[model samples]
Target: MTRLRIVLADDHPLVLMGMRDLLEKDFSFEVTATLDSPTALVEHLRRHPAHVIITDYSMPGDETYGDGIRLVKYLRRHFPVPRVVVLTMVSNPMIISALYDAGVSAVVLKRHNLNEISAALHTLQAGRRYYPPGFQRDGAIDARNKFIGERINSLSPKEYEVLRHFVRGESMMQVAESLKRSIKTVSGQKISAMRKLNVQTDQELVAFCVTSGIFP
Candidate 1:
């Protein structure tokens, strides 16, 4: 029997090492590459084919393939063959939903038992989607989170980009410059995003972004 080829990526060295060791102990898995950044993962995937990829949801350093949904989308767009499983600590239902929409095969919360990783892989092999325990419970999603998630998904791409930049600590002027839009235009986009998110102040916006794990 052929061992499953896998690539593991995480910004934290310890987490990356532990995951590699844990998966390698299982006779069925062969970890082909362990990468620390989105760039390295993409570079490695370009030259080598893997059966599966397990990567962190938030790896903050790479500017080209920013983390979270964007990174997931990039991976799906460039390498559609490999099954992508995201490892994240985020519990936000909205963000998790977005990840699925971005084409992730599964999401394994960091706080869950490491064994879930193996289970996720097996579930995928069986031609089914894997969700963490309680993912389907009605009580798992609150009214407020559902509302916020719906509203968040409604933001236009430009508005979403403005809010993302703001959450990353960029000033309106800087965001405007980076996006090549005028300050007034950028400010309008920010306000529109805030309204859509139901945030009344910049602090509130930042707090929502942090708590919701949307910009992570």
Candidate 2:
């Protein structure tokens, strides 16, 4: 059996060390290189390509390859052969969707049991796509709607409260009064919620809430 060669990239040093230990100690996988930034990882890849690349979705880079979708796109385009596995704290559906479209072999959420990484690797070795557990379950009727629901779920409790009031036809000031929060606080929460859901306008945000069943 040919041993799997792996390359790793993450911004945090501790995370990089921990991942290397896990892969080498128990899995007996050969970790060719461990890097602290996407830029360094890309450089290492150019020098030494591996059978698989496990990377954090967000990593510090100078400008072009700084983070998220851009780095993922670069790896898929440049190397193309080494299967890509994203280990990330980001659960944003839109970003995850972009990674999938960019041809990532698997996505393992950092919050999930590390065992999920094992599962993702197994599936990838078999030539199948692996998502965070339960992402594809329940036979979701519409992918977009499902993603919207997930984005909503990612919001903070206060953010969700502000958004709920706005969806009920309340103005930002009105929501502030009802929630006993200052207008500025309510507005901030609303803005944060909108950013998380990737909506630019109040109308669009409320429409998303209604469509996703968060507002009825």
| Candidate topping TM-score | 1
In the range 76-165, model 1's lDDT, one tens digit per residue, is 999999989999876656667777888999999988999999899888878888998767454556898877767777776667767877
Model 1, residue 53: C-alpha shift (Å): 1.0
**Residue pairs in candidate 2 whose N, alpha carbon or C atoms collide under 3 angstroms:** none
Give the backbone clash total of model 2.
0
How close is every model to the real structure, measured as TM-score?
0.77, 0.64
lDDT of each: 0.83, 0.76
lDDT of 2 at 161: 56
Worst window of 10 by summed lDDT in candidate 2? 58-67
Q: Residue 80 CA error for candidate 2 (Å)?
A: 0.9
Task: Give the least accurate 10-residue stretch of model 1, judged by summed lDDT.
Answer: 132-141
